[model samples]
Every structure is written in structure tokens, then in C-alpha cells.
Target chain A: MQFNANTKMAEVIHVNYLLLPILNRFDIQLGFGDKTISEICAEQKINVDFFLEIINSFHDYNYFPQDRLQSFPLDLIIEYILKSHYYYINIKVPLIETTIITLSTSSDKLQNKYVQLIVKFFQEYKEELINHITDEEIRVYPYMLSVDKALRSGNIGKELVEKVKKNPIRIIESEHTNIEDKLFDLKNIIIKYLPPATNYSLSNTLLIELFRLEQDLNDHARIEDKVLVPKVEMLENQILQKL
Target chain B: MNLKKTIICVKSPIIYRGIAYCIHSIQPGIELEHYNNIDKLLKDDNHEDKLFILDINLLPDPAFYFLERMFVNFQDLTLIALSERFLSDKLAVYFRGSILITDSEEIVKNKLKNIIDTGKEINRTNRKNSAISEREQEVLRLVAFGFTNKQISDQLYISTHTVITHRKNISSKLGIKTIAGLTVYAIINGIISPDEML
Candidate 1:
């Protein structure tokens, strides 16, 4: 089922504006406000359906009217994005960058070529990718963390948690489609590092090294996409109830 | 079918629960007891005459301790393996005369019955082969196939002294005095083929 943050039709009475600034500062310090998404969800006994719905809601920019943020728990949603989405990318992308650097400087020519291709791929997609990361960190994660803190301290009240519950995490997941497409494009380009038959010793050595680097990157990306991101989002929601 | 009491000794609660569910569903009139710690289960005198279901994932050290103790203490108890997916491949060479391997509870129940029935049949077929443990059978198979103590140790990844100990146990159990006698007995009991012996 899709999560709808606005479904509860809670009256859009303006709360204190100071709360936003306080939550934003809190989110940055707590690494998306403490507990990880997976741990929170697991602790809260939140179902997979609810988790997916919440994710989808965050990424569904077109369907979710921009003005709706005033009505929705904007701070909490931002925290979710920061911890669940941006945090994983933040941790993984640098590792991938380092791997690319290592592969490029390898003495083997084949390895260098493969690394060069990866570097080029990242360079080409840099704007779109960086923007995605920045948007999550700046906008989505902080919001989610605020909601988490509200839920945990019993300060926000159950009405807010129920409203947040209605909003599916799936919205953000839908936006991941674009992100995944770019990642796949990079992966496809990187796959060319496989060992190719060559009489030249230098080319053959480079190819083997390149193949290994590609494998490492692929594994790194898979862990980020499959495990880390979802877990982080879950944590943000859980922290809402606790903090 | 007579109601047989089965005891499952596995480390993982998920697997243990899954097996318990399957065994309860498939086998009627069978009592299934689950234990995470084999040592605790073994210490209980109530374990007598019950089918012992072991997971190979539970083995190689701490689990091996239980297996060795069981061989010494509970000779009549039939021990069957609820194996990990990879264990079937790893243990295939030794499985011929040693452990009966299965992944599911229903299959384990059926295999346990077969082992019990086969135990009875072996007793009827020849009294001389009645006392061999699964490990002894494994050592016997390796020995019959012409593996020296060191070779057997290397193949099984055990010490040569351990291989020698297994060999000694095989001789004592089967009433065979020499390696040649052990080889002849292993061949007659289908532990190893003549070609394998060469």
C-alpha cells in the first residue's frame, strides 16, 4: 500500500517556525538523527509495505504538490532522505571514487583504461548524481529526522505519526528509477574491463586489472543500493518515535 | 509405521523452527524435540532411542565434540545430518558409508527411518559390522581406497594421528586385525569398490 503523508487530512494549522531550524541543526549532528532506518523499522515493527510507501512518497515529486510540504511533516521527511538516502550515497560514492583512482593509476595498461572509462562515466553523470545526493541531504533527510524525533519524544503526538504512516516511502523509491538508470549506464560502460585476448603483455595485464576493479565497484554499488539506503530510511522513521 | 522419537540439534532458530514445522506436518505420531545446544541435549538421559538430527553447519569443532561423545556414549542412536546446501558437495566423498544428508525435515525424517531400518537390516545381514560409527565408516572407505594415514589426514583435513585413531577404531569395531582385513571387509560391505581400492 502507498504511504500518504497528507491522507490523514489533519488541519494545516501552522506550528512554531523555530522548530524547523532546531530540527535541521539536530539532523546534521546526529548523522540523520541517530538510529539507522533498518534498526528503527525493525524496532517499531513497521511492515515492509509501510516502509516502501514512505520511500515512494519522498521521490514522487510530480504527484506530490510542492506546496504540500507546509501541510506535511517537512522536517521529518528531510531527515529520512538525509539518513536513508543521502547517507548511503555519501558513504559509497567516495569508495567508488577511490577505487576508480586506484584502478587508473595501476601499472597495468588494461587496468588503467578500465579505470579511465569508469572515471569518464562518473564525470559524465556527475551533475545529475551529485544533485540527487544534495537534494536528499538538504531536503528529504532532515524532514524525516524531525518526524522521527517528534514521534520518539511523544512531543509530535500520534496524529502526526499516523499521518506520516499514510505516506508511503515508495515515492522516493520511484525517483530511484532515474538514479538506477544512471548507475546501470555507468555499470554497462565499466563492464568493458573484462580480459580481452591480446598478444601485447601490457594490454592483457591492464584488462585483467580493469576487470577486477569493475567487479569491486559493482559489489560496492550493489551493497549501497540493496542494503544501506533502505536501511537508513527505516532508521529515520524509527528515530522519529524515539527521539 | 511405529512412532519414532526424533531430536533435532541445530544452531539456527530459523532453520530449527522450519524443520520442526515440516516434520510435524509430514510425519504423524512422531515426537520432535528441538535443541540448539547439542551438549545440553546429550547430557539429558531422555535422549536415548531418539533419532538425532544434526546440522553439518554445527560441525568441524564444537559440534565435532558432541559427535565424538555421541559415538562413545550413544552407539544405538541413529545420527542423521540436516545439511547446509554446500555441505552436500563437501561431504559427498565421505557420505557413501558415513552420514545420511538431507536439507528438509520431511526428507530428514524419511532418511532417519531408512537409517534405522537399514541398521536393523545390517544387523540381520552380518553381526560383525554392527559396531562401526559413521566416522569409522569414512576412515574405512578412505583406507579401502588405498589412502595412507597421511593421505587420509590430508584429504579429510585431520591429523595423521587422528586418521590412525580412526583406523584403530575400525579394526576394533569390525574385529579385523590388519589393514588388508579392513580392506576386504570394506569391499564386502560396499564401503569401497575394487577399482577404488586400486
Candidate 2:
């Protein structure tokens, strides 16, 4: 179901409880009783259209409208992305890691060893994820923001030009591959390899969290690749052409 | 007999669980792996003696090629097409049998039981090629240990080309392509100990 500005805020969560985190990233909280999405967005000073797009994209995987998302100001999308990165690093990663740690401690000796291996594998993935996020935060996002500023103010400064020429957003477009592959492997290891003696409930929880994170990251990557990069590339071209 | 495991690749969680519940009820000790997609199931599984319950609608574009790949690559697999409605005879030819989502629980159990028993009987008579050879197992062991084909060939005193062919047959027979997957399979099956991995 597609959510719109007129849709009640509480009903969205009723449809999919998984969307609660996405709503939280938007600074939306519970007790939005009988309030329409636009009403809550207006109160929080959030862009209603952008909020709807984000919620709809998360709610329905196939509902991402690339053109509509690209039409938003680059900083707006970047701000949302920054919030997502925060959610991933500070929230999702910790939750999954802690769960794995707890699962390892609670299992039998043999299962515990495998869980430890998984913990190590997950640590590697987490490191790679953090590195990727750090690159985007320190290098890529700042570069895109500067380009956004140049495009907005029509002032292509020397530093901004050098930055654009030095680090094109296209370079890291395929960087999501390794992280994605590692996540796939992690899931497969749990699904097919974990022995029958392991804790089913805990394994189920880990699988759920991993699958959620995978979906969230995939959607986030699609936005970055399909929308953010192309928009920034356009801004870069405009700035260079004027120069 | 490779009937100890089953892989269900269906989109609907309810149907997947329902079928799994029936299978477990019928054969409590069976190893069941559930997947929502066909490609992941095919790639990660050890297809030897494993029954695949595939959602017909979830097949990739050019589904015939995928079905053909299963027929050619994995001779030991018993595929059961799953759908909410009846399938045409042409498409139905791809499956050893078809399970309708609308089948009652008892009906489903009987169907699964028949498949499991018949699968074992069929494999016992003429399935020598379906089993992994000793040389192939040695190659798989080294492969899981992160050895290259040349290294495995050298250790086993086989030609590199023979090692490659063995690896191909191992992958085709087992449906496990990644080193990590094979390693996990080796550990689980006791071909390689978890300590060896360390």
C-alpha cells in the first residue's frame, strides 16, 4: 500500500512494524494519534513530500520513484542519508552485534565455536561497513554538498572545482559490492550451515535482523546510486560548464 | 540416499512454513532450508539428495534455462513445482511432481512422503554418479581449506585439468559454489573438522 500525506501516521506502523525505525530516523515518535502524516511533518518541520517518499520507499520496496527522489534538493537527500548512516552504525549494527554475542554465549560448545566464527565474520563486515560509511561521510558527502552549494549559489570556487575533479561520485558507485557480498555470505552461513543443535529462536532473531538490515541497506544504496550520484553529477557538470 | 534434506523456495511465508511443517511432521529429522528466491537456494545448497520445492512464479526471466540448468547440472535433485493454481502440462514437465498451495495438510503430507520414499528408492538403484567420488571429496576438502586448483592437483597427484573437472562436478553435484559454503558443508558433514578451519 502506498502511503500519502493524508494517510494517518499510526496506520503506517500498523501495516509494517519494521518501519518504526525509519520513522524514528525522521524524528517521528509514537502518540501521533489520529494525526495525518502531513500534520506530523508540519509540526516537526519535516518536508512532508520527502517524508512520504522515504516512508513509501521503505514500506513498499517496489515503490521507489527515482525521478521524484532525484528532484529533491541534494542536501535534503544527503541529510536523510546521513540519518540512515547514523541509524546503521549507531543502532542496527550494535543491535545485531550484541545479539550475536549473546547468542554465542548461550549456545552449546560446538555451536558456540561456529557462532564465534560468525561473530568474527560479522566483525569483518562491520569494519567494512564502517569504512564505507566513513568514506561517504568524510569524502563523498562533503564533496556532493560543496557541489550542491556551488550549483545553488552559482559560485564555482577553486576548491570545489578541484574537489569535483579529484573525486567524482562515479568512482565509488560499485563500492557497495563487497559489503553486499559479505552480507550475503553471512546470511547463507547462518541459514545452511548452522547445526540443528543451535538455538532456533535466537537464530531466527539474527536472521530477521540481518535480513532487515540487508533490505534497508539495499534501498539506501539504490537511492545513493540511482538518485544522489546522478543529481550530484548534474550539478558538477553545470558548475564545470559555467567555469 | 540424499533424502535427508529438503529446500523450499517459495515467496509466501505462510506457504513455506506450511510445507515445512508438513515435511517435518512426516520426517522429523530432515534438514530443511527455506529460501524466498530460487537463485540463492540453487547456489548455496548441496543439491545431492535434496528435494527442491520451487515457486514456479519466482523463476527468473527465461525460466526454461534455469529449469534446464537444474536438469543438466544436478542429476540427483528432485524438483517439486509449487503454485497456487494448476500448471500446464508443458511447464509441469520440469518437475518430478507439483504441489498446489491449496492442497490440504494431510494431502500435502502424503505427497511429500511419497516423494521422499520414491526419491530414496530411485537413488538406491541407479545413482552411483549422484554420489561424490573420493577424489572429488579430497578436492572439495582442499577447496574448503582455501587451496587453489593447482595446489589441490599437486597434493592429490592429479592433473590441473582433472582437478578443474572434479571441482566442476563437485559444484554441479552439490550446488555449492563458494569456498565459504563448501567449507561450512565440510565442517557440518565432518569431512573437515571445525578445528581444521581454525
Candidate 3:
């Protein structure tokens, strides 16, 4: 879809379903009717550039440039990425875990162990995800911020620049694969091994949650792996060249 | 004054005459070559800075294709699209820095004057060689498909940091900043097709 100032909010959603959660973060209600994206954002006082860049990136990442991205606050991208992380950690994971817990309490001895296994698998996945995000939030994101700061000033210390340039982007990369393995394993376990007789409805619900998480987790990993890692590497390289 | 490096493609004799007249009036000593067919104009590749003006209303498809092909292969050229009415809705998304002008000679003269006055050719040479890298193009292809940075990294087997570096460099080189803008550029530059975009 060719998004412009006059593009309707409803039209964008119609084009890309993935953009729904992105809009929801900005308090953009679905009942916006035929209002143009620019108009709705104006009323809401949202940064239209930031909103457009995020949606467009979600719709298609190739459209954005560094300077254009620089026009909007980098904090917004960081914030958006962080929010996605929060959604997975606080909301999506817990919802799935809660369903697993409910399944455990149901009056079926045979399914109880299976339910416990699923719940335990999810907890492990959650721990890994939390640890990965926390690492990014604590170590990597701050480094990016400092890079942004140095970029703006046009002067960076040799050691500081080299530190970022050499920052362990590779270290965090393996974690994504590990997470993918666990998610994939848990999904296969549920589909192939879980006995669905007693907790048929519950298992179905669990299956649905798992499927959704699987998709969401893929997107999450993509954001981290494709988007975040590349950005930092770029910043690091820029600093290195300057040094 | 020397019309050694410009190509104008317009099928209409009357419109072509008007443009010629306008160019002569703007700079009386200036020289020009006109072609009724876009194919003839693109027949030879010039290494010097060149300006190409296409009448969008006449054979619009080939005109756009010609422009994009020139952009990808030829390197240093300024492209102009002249139409009787605004055809931006259908064509603007594919505009890769091409100046869009209506069929008014006065408007064309004004726009062309700006290009000439700024000495546009001198700068284009510097930009031609700094084309987006192969890796950046790969990042661009995935980005157009809406893969988040991390997803792109996983698929390409590159670190997310490397993907970002490519993206930043891609944006800077293309002079486009939004994902949608980059998407349009990819299509225009033949990096990706319109059908490929979702």
C-alpha cells in the first residue's frame, strides 16, 4: 500500500494485519472510521513521522533511511522495540502460562504431568527471553544510545568508539537460535506428544496460544535479530571508520 | 550553451516544439537534441552528466522502464517526467529523485534553471560510484518484505548489527528515510518489483 498523508487509517489495517498491534500501542482506536492516518495522528498528537516509520517498517523495512530515521527520535524506535518485548514477556507468555496452569488444575491425572511439562517448558522459554531482552536493555541499548550521542556530537573517543565497534553483536545472536529451538521443541511436543482426551478443549486453547506465541516470537526475534543487531553494527562500523 | 549532454523524449511534435522554444528563450545560445522515441534517446550511454526528460503521457510504461534502466546502469543522469496532467498517484511512488513537471514550458524552464544553476552534474559524479552495496541491497530486499531487523539477520545469517549497518548505509545512500520510501526506491531501482512488495 502506498501510504501517504491522506491514506485512511482503516485502509492501512486492511492492508497489513501485523500493523494492528503497532497502532494499538499509540492508543489509535480501531473505530477510527475513514479518518486519514495523518489526521488521526494529529488529533492524538502522536509523532506522525515516528508512527509512519514504525508502521512502514513493520509493513516494509526497506523504506526507511538513517537521516529520515534520525529526524524522529531514536528513542521512539527503542521504545517501540521495548514495548514489543514487554508484550511478549508480560502479556503473551503469561497468558500461555496461565492456560497451562489452568490445564494442570483440571481433574485429569494423566494430563496433569503433560500440562506441567508444557508449563515448565514455557517458563524456561520465558527465562531465556527475559535474559536476552534484559541484556539488550542493559548492555546493548545503552551502547546504541551512546553511539547516537556521539554521532550527534561528531566526536567520539577512540576507546569508546572501538568499544562499540567491537561490542559483541555475535554473542546475542546465538540466543535467538536457542530460543527458536526451545519454542520449536515445545510446539512439536504439544502437537505430537500431548494427550488431548481429557483436556481436549483446554489443549486446543493451549495449542492456539502456542501457535500465536510462535508467530509473535518469530516477529520478536526478527526485530532483535534483523533490526536491532544490524543497527548497532552500523553504528559500531561508523565509529570505527571515524576512529 | 552546448546541448552535448541532454536527451528529451516526447512523441508530440507540438509539445516538443514548445519545449524547444522555451529552452531557446531561457538561454538563447543553448543547443538541444530531441527524439520522438525513448528508445533512440537511450540508444547510447553517456559518461558525462546528462538530463533526460520523458513525456509521461506518451508511452508511459516504456518511459518509466527506460528511466529506471538508465538509473541502474548509466549512473549519472537527471530525469524529468512531463505530463499534461498530474500523474503522481500512479507514478510518484516510483519516482527516484526524478523531477516531475507538467506540460507548461514556463514551469519546465523554472525547474530546469534550478538544476543548471546549481551545477547539478558536478555532484552526481560523486554519488554515482557510491551506489548501495550488494549486502545493502540484500537488506533492502528483506526490508521491503517487512522482515524486522532480527528476522533479516536470522534469514541472512548475519548479525542483527550488520543488518542495521546495511540499513543505515542504504538509507543514507538512497536519500530516503522511511521504510515505505525505501520500498518505493527498491522498486524504482529494480532492486525489487512492485509485485514483490506486500
Candidate 4:
């Protein structure tokens, strides 16, 4: 999807009905009095470029404009990104979970077992996903912000920054990838091996929702892994160069 | 299946405490024991199928005397040697009788979960007949046949790092370390015929 500031929200959603949730998330209303996305975002006091970056990223992951991201205020970016995390944790997850329980309990005997397994798999997946973002929110991001603060203040020692660099972050990357893996497992179970023919609409709805989530979730992590990590490393280097 | 208890034998209370903390982090609420003097603890305690973790660097008794003595007494127990240094010849022989050769603390921290998992596997196997995953068993079979880590990775179509991981799992699951020891295990398990090796 070639998303731009002037593109109408109606036109975008026409192609992908799943994008409604993401648009509604930022209070970017559908009937924007016929306003363009950029105009509507500006009206809401949202950072238009940041919104574009996120939406475009949500649109196409491989098209992350790393160059445009440098001028983006990280504080604003992080806040907006953190809100996306809350949207998953507080809203989407519980909604999906309740849907699973409601749908699963209504299944017949043979199907109930499979439905139970699906619910179990999703519960475990939800836990891991929460932990993944929670670690980033509670630990990694705060550390990066501190590094940013230290750099901006011109006082954090080279030794400390070096120490942070020396410490391996592959653990986080592995865990972050683990979250993706659990979803893939769920997807395989749903698409390939799901029990035959009961509540087809409910089952299809769950799969579609999962398909949408997988994209949004991976994009979220891509932003964190690709954009934030490298940007912080750049800040560290800039500080080193100054010294 | 009964949950297995883990015992750590080391001289320094400080280091023992550190190892205990790391183990606890990997697995919470398992039975764990620490003793400067293993013989005394063995005599006093009645744990069947206990898994022992020993740091040979700190073994006050000559490695052979203590390791052999403990093996004789705790026939059902599995042993894992934890240390930073390579084993001395005598110590190496003793390690061959045990279940694992744990690397330094840093490597241990990274591989700790796999270590504990393997120990539990060995413990539950009713002494020396633990079932490894098919892939791990294949790695073990190749390793026993004297392939290098890289060669095994190539043969298995997996990365050298994955081969190393499987090797670690193999060591933890079966206390035999040397190529000779592993060959004996492989033959006993019918992983490969003696005629095939010859």
C-alpha cells in the first residue's frame, strides 16, 4: 500500500479492512469531514511524519525508511510506540482471549479438545508476547533512554557506554524472535491442522485476526530492533567522537 | 515420574552460593543441596536418583580418590563437573564416569537452562538409559564416531553452533566425555554396530 499524508483513510481501509483498528488507535477517524490523513492527524496534534512512518511500516515491513527515522524525536516515537504496546496488552489480547474462551466452550466433543489446545497455545503465546514487550518497556528502553540522557548531558563516561556495547543483546533478539515463533506455531495449527468444520466463521475470524496481529506485532519489534537499537548505538558513537 | 533433586559439591561456600543462585534462576523450587564435604553429606542424606554437580578445581580430595569414592557410594547418582580449567589427566578419567563437563561461570549462565534440563533427563531415565531427542541422538551418534563439531554440523545440515549445543546436551545427558567413552555408549545403545565402526 503506497501510504502518504494525502491518502484518504477510506481508500486505505478499502484495500485492507484490518487497518481499522490501527487507525482508530490514534483517534484518526474515518469521516474526517473529508480531510486528508495528514490534515486529520495535524488536527489531533499528532506527529504526522511519525504517524506516516508507523502506518507505512505497518503497510510494508521491508520498506522501513531508516533515513527518515533519524530526525524523528525518539521521545515522541517511544511514547506512541508504547501506546501500541498497551493497545495489545490492555485491549487486543484480552479481546482475543475472551473470544477464544467463548468460541472454544461452545465446541462439540471432538472439536472441544482441539479448541482447548488452541486456547492453551494462545494463552502461552499471550504470556510470552507480554513478557517480550514488558522486558523492553521495563528494562531495555529505560536503559537506552538513560544512555540518551547521558549523551545529551555530555557526562556519561566512555567506559559505561563501552560496557553496554560489550554486553550481548542477542538474548533479547532471541526472545523477541521467540514471540514470533509462537504465533507461527499457532498459525500452522489453525491453517493446516484445525479440526474440520464447526463454527467456520468463528475459526476464520480468529485466523484473520491472528494474521493481522502477526504483521503489526512483527512491525512493532522491527521498529524496536532495527530503528531504536541502531539509533541508540549512533548516539553512543556520537558521544565517543565528541570525547 | 518423580522430580529429581540436584546436589552441588564445592569447597567455597561463596562459589557454591553463586552456583546455587544461578541454578535457582534456571529452575525454581527444585530440591538442591550444597556441601563442602560430599562424603559426609552422602552418608547423612538418603536421596535416590540425585544429580550431583561438582567443581573439580575445588575438590580437596585428589580428584580420582574423591570422584571414584563418590561414584562407588552413590551408584544411582549422575555427576557433572563444573570448572573453568581443563581437567587434569586423572581428573579427566574421573569426568569420563560423570554426566557432564560444565564450562566456566559465564558459559554456564548462558547454557544453564539446557544443563539443568539435561540433568533432569538423565535422572529420570532410571540410571544410564535416558532417551535423547532423535536429532540429539544422531548428533551423539556422529560425535561418538569421531567427527569434529564442524563435520557433524555439515553432516546434520545444521550450524556448528547447533552442533555444539547438541554436544552440550549429549554431555549432560550422558556423563561420558571421551570419544572412547561415547563409542562404548553408542554401541551399548545400538546406535551403531561395532562392525560398522571397525
Look at candidate 3 and tell me the lDDT of residue B195: 43
Instruction: Give the per-residue lDDT of model 3 (tens digit) for B70-144.
Output: 668765555556655434333432332233333244445644554454344224333243356545655786787
Q: Which residue pairs show backbone clashes in model 2?
A: B2-B49
What lDDT score belongs to each candidate, Candidate 1 first?
Answer: 0.49, 0.77, 0.64, 0.65
Better of 3 and 4 by lDDT: 4
Candidate 3's fnat?
0.00
B96: Cα error in model 4, Å: 39
Off by over 4 Å in 1: A1-243, B1-3, B59-66, B85-110, B119-198
Residues forming the 10-long window of minimal summed lDDT in candidate 4 chain B: B119-128
> lDDT tens digits, residues A1-243, model 3?
557778999999889876787787787888988899899999999888777866776577456444555445556678877887777788888888888888889837745744655665577678887887788789778877787778779979776755764554655455433456566556655664345647678778888877777766665566556566677667667777775
Task: List candidate 3 segments past 4 Å from native.
Answer: A1-5, A11-18, A47-53, A56-73, A168-177, B1-198
TM-scores of chain A in all candidate models: 0.36, 0.95, 0.80, 0.87
lDDT of 4 by residue, A1-243 (tens): 678899876777776766776777687767755677788888899888888887777776577788687568667768867878888889888877887887787788756755766676678778877887888889777766777787777788766666566742444445553566567556655665455537788877787778778887887777777787777767767766775
Tell me what TM-score chain B of candidate 1 gets against the true chain B.
0.46
Misplaced by over 4 Å in model 2 are A175-177, B1-186, B189-198
Model 3 clashes, total count = 21
Candidate 2's residue-wise lDDT over A1-243, tens digit each? Answer: 898888899899888898998898889999989999989999999999998998888888888899899999888898899999999999999999999998998898867866877787788778989999998899788878888887888877898788677767777565533567667667876776566435678889999999999989988888888899999888888887887
Report the candidate with higher lDDT, 2 versus 4. Answer: 2
Error in Å for residue A105 of model 3: 2.0
Candidate with the greatest DockQ versus the true structure: 2
The alpha-carbon deviation from the true structure for residue A50 of candidate 2, after best TM-score superposition, in angstroms, is: 0.5
